[model samples]
Target chain A: MKKRSALIIIFTLIVGLSGLSSKTFAETAKNNYRLYCSQCHGLTGNGEGIDKPTMGVAPKIHNNAEEMIKLKDADIYTVTAQGGASVTKSALMPPWEGVMSEAEIKDMVKYLRELCNCTEK
Target chain B: MKMTKLTCLILFSLALTLPVRIAAAGDGKTIIEKNNCGTCHKMEGPAAKTFAEALSRKAPDLFYAGSKFQEEFLVEFSQKPYQIRPAGTLYLNHVKTVDGVDRIQDPPLCASRLSKEDAVLASKYLMTLKDPDMKIGVYKPGASFFKIGAKMIFTKSVACIGCHQVKKRGKIVGGTSGSSLYNAGSRLNGDWLSSYIRNPHYWDPMSPMPKWDLGEHAWMQLTNYIMEMKE
Candidate 1:
């Protein structure tokens, strides 16, 4: 009976630790988004950042879950990492490969999914 | 005779110390601090934490002043400040409606003006805050490649023309969100421009400019194109 309780305790601790780590990851991703994307993408991902009005072309609204749901994760990652120009989109979304690490880029993609409340296919 | 000799020795010591005192009296850092320049300007890094704070920033980051500005320009501009960004640094905040017409507000005149002597000292001190990571001659594309770079800047790669005003067909064109790059060739150092283009946040953490992961060749070409935009 004690061994079983100990196993249960270890399982609970593992789950709790994982939950905490994911929360920290999300927080980091949010900070990164604020640093790099929020300037043009807006703090709420509504595509109404201060630079939006001044931009020659409007940035895509990330808050629109319906639209975001249709986009593939790979496509979104490509746009974020390689820039909009790589996919024949706006050049205003400059590449982040030089500025951010691959792990960070992946985190940003995951954050974007969370922002839109969409699940990967 | 002994009293006369003592007087001569005192005079010699005083003469030796006068020049040193005069030279050390006008320390630029002291003058900047005395004027409370840090209240408006960012002398160091790790930009504002929040968007509101970033938007509220009044003056440009001066940490890279050593690497970015020409000494003569710095000295002259400090004494007689002029508008560098026509749209103001935070242009979005300056937009206002006057008489049912929307217009961009004029930037405030630089409140801090230094005398010629103080300006020289300040400029000298500012020029010492160079980014040690930046090395010259990393990329030096020749005049022949300027046309290709111009094309890339306009349409192909990073669309700098989308935000910054550039000369096209003898007419200033492009967005007003950023500082006009029409005279960047004369106003900015090529090395500084290259570093800024590669990673703007390195110079100013709150920079709204997006990072471009252009290869060295591409960035070099863009740099050449920008430097060709002389007065």
Candidate 2:
């Protein structure tokens, strides 16, 4: 009976540990980008998406590596979570704090770094 | 004594009814109709349209304008006739109608801009567009299949709130010249909104608002966010 209980306890730990390690959560961040960001940012993070032609104001291009590298993780996170309003940017870019999760936001930060080929400072 | 009392009662009733009867003599709405407000305005939603069906296809449907606009906003815009957000690329189609094969423009020669008094009256009548019967369901997302997070991104950081309205904590506050999105959830279908966000020209050929640059999830979330605006 003692050995059986120990095994059950060990199994639960494994299950809980695996849940935290699952990379699936990170993937959703990309999906979030496709649905919300793609209209203005382009699918590949290049900045020239389908919505560009009609925009009264031009969206910034994310294609540059040096500039993308200079942006801190906090800056990107702030812009994403708080919106353009927080950073004195366009109000058209509404804040997403009410809509998105903190984890998803961090994942987006990492994904942007990958897309821009920039490393965190 | 009884006869004198009856005469006094009759005279008082006539005094009360005289002004009320004269005030109801003219229908302000009919005066607007005679001037041809229908040529450019629709007074009700597409669901139960009356008083004017011909005008719907000609101009921006005024059916929801009553609910969509504020008193001062409508009066000012009607008098000066400033450009509503330049129609996106779809402006071309708006200027001309596409038939089976041939396309034709239905441009109007008469200007619809109204005088201050008429604009006020028109605004008064137009602002009555609330339909207590129409209620949309709130968006509810169940368990998700993929990982999720809240971090959102914006393009080169333009100031969008300068003209457009967005919902914040069940309150509608923002700019006015652009169409009010106070009830966009009920006003726009999700698929149509998604496509429009990606390319406004795709749906509205003459829209002046530029295209946005967010990804699919971001777009969906934005739509979901807008959908939250309701009674």
Candidate 3:
């Protein structure tokens, strides 16, 4: 009876956790990039996103080391969390504060630096 | 023993006739099941709880079909279905790196080609699946509202135009990330639209749609404007 119960519990655990993944959330900055940022920012963060053609104001290319290097780390964090419109940019870039945690946003700022391969000058 | 045998024969005959009665009556559900619509669309919920589960979903939930869509639209759409969301359902799944440039691919359009009679019957069954939580009659068709103001809010204030496609002076313009709202007035129920705008996560917990902190008037104005779009 004990062996059968243990097997049942193990099966239930596998089935219950099948589609559920923390990887889908903002657990890692790379996962977060795929989840929310990839649609508009492009998978490479090159601003060649699928939505670029229709957007009134193009999404800024995050991978451009020169352009990205001009902005401070705090500025990047602000735009990522508070949105572009808050800093006199496009309203098309909606805020992600509701969707991501502070730590996650901070991590994304770091990720953007990594994507650009440059730090703020 | 003879009487018992007779009763069994009678029962068997009744069972054989039950399907005939159901066919004559509205067996629209049977038609839907026969076509296996559940293979794609979710017919029941407790919706997907996690983002991963939501992403894995192949089609929209049909459990609350009655509350979301108009009967006429549903009936017609089932017969001649087109892709409404330009980026496909869960755009993440369809994004492809084509020629080193990321491009969006089209999701398969429905090819069911249901007969008019079957479409009507199936819609009748779908229209019966209402969500009690959704409050109806929030938007009145003939109510006084300003389109210019509503348009301004949609395109500028909340920037819904960033994702949803809308008509612009006979031109099909605006982003295609979200479902096109060009025919929203005729396609969607007003109450459901209002509720969804306030909180899309209410219906789809893992939806990436941003809920703006706009005033009540702005929200209603946006709803009124969207509900004005047709055909």
Using Cα atoms, each model's DockQ against the true complex is 0.22, 0.05, 0.33
Candidate 3 lDDT over residue span B1-231, tens digit each: 999999999999999997765663357788788888988788898676565677788888889999999999988999999989987887877788787567877776666678888898888788888899888788878687878899888888778887788898999888766899999999999999999998887787667787667788887898889998999
lDDT of 1 by residue, B33-145 (tens): 87677887888965554456666788777877888877887788788887666557766556454453234577776667999888888877778777888877664635467
What stretches of model 1 exceed 4 Å from their correct place?
A1-28, A53-57, A114-121, B1-27, B44-58, B80-110, B137-144, B167-179, B201-210
lDDT of 1 by residue, A1-121 (tens): 9999999999999988876431123337776776567546766777765456657788777778988988998998899988997898888888877656688788898999999898666
lDDT of 2 at A63: 54
TM match of model 2 to true structure: 0.34
- Model 3: residue A109 alpha-carbon error in angstroms: 2.4
| Models ranked on lDDT | 3, 1, 2
Q: Of 2 and 3, which scores higher on lDDT?
A: 3
Candidate 3 docking band: acceptable
Q: Residue B142 error for model 1, in Å? A: 8.2
The clash count of every prediction, one per candidate, is 0, 62, 0
- In model 1, state the lDDT of residue B45: 67
lDDT of 2 by residue, A1-121 (tens): 9999999999999988876531223336666565446545655666654444445555555656877878889988998887765788765555555345588788878878778888766
**Global lDDT of each candidate:** 0.73, 0.53, 0.83
TM-score against truth, every candidate = 0.67, 0.34, 0.82
